[model samples]
Target: MYHVVLGVDEDEQRAESAAREIANLPGGSDEKRVTLIHVFQDNPSGASATQVASVRDAEEVLKAAGVDVSISEASGDPADAILELAEEDDADLVVVGGRKRSPAGKALFGSVTQTVILNAGRPVMVTGVPTEA
Candidate 1:
């Protein structure tokens, strides 16, 4: 079993695509198991039900694919939450979704994927989110 923490965002299609890709991976087969996690920071304004639904919907896709899925939520900084979970779970791999950014921008304010890859003891997979044309 592998710990596959798929980060979800407002674009349901992207998250669904990510979940589908994870599902198709050899390690995500019926013989294997994976966990699905979503991080939610407390935005003072709050998140609409639609955003939460996207995560729940993605979880369903992974579960239907035969992966032993666990859905969870986390608060605080995105990178910190992921790293904490990785260490606490002794995860084999950490997966994340990212939007492409300039190196300078990324370096100034580290991306969640970049930070996790640099600090995580385990392997990390980062999927870049496609900006709608």
Candidate 2:
């Protein structure tokens, strides 16, 4: 079976995009499984991964497409958590969402997507918010 680790943040658009990508993979969903993960850097209220809006939206899209879905949660650094989960799951691919940022902005704020792409030993798919026509 093909496995994928989909790392989602608070951005619902990006999460849906990544989910759609997985749903549209060449092979049918019968052999595909997705682990939807969300990492919280600081959670004062202690939210679960299943409680994440982005994760819920992605899950609906994936399930409607007949893909198997699972949820995982972690605390601390987002990139590190995502990578760890991907490794543990032996994921065939890691998917993440990215926002368009200026070089200076990215330098100042840092990018979890960039870090994951650079560090992931396996394939990483980065999805961005869709542009309006």
What digit string (tens of lDDT, one per residue) describes model 2 on residues 1-133?
Answer: 8999999899899899999999998799998999999999889998798888999999999999999999999999999999999998899999988787787676632378888998999999887788999
- Candidate 1 achieves a global lDDT of 0.68
Report how far residue 84 has shifted in candidate 2, in Å: 0.5
Candidate 1: list runs displaced more than 4 Å.
Answer: 43-51, 102-110, 130-133
Most accurate candidate by lDDT: 2
Evaluate model 1: give its TM-score.
0.75
- Whole-model lDDT values for every prediction: 0.68, 0.90
Clashes by residue pair, model 1: none
> What is the clash count for each candidate, in the order shown?
0, 0
lDDT of 1 by residue, 1-133 (tens): 5666665665576677777777877743765455555666665656643358767777778778877776666767777877887777777777776565687676543366678778888888766555679
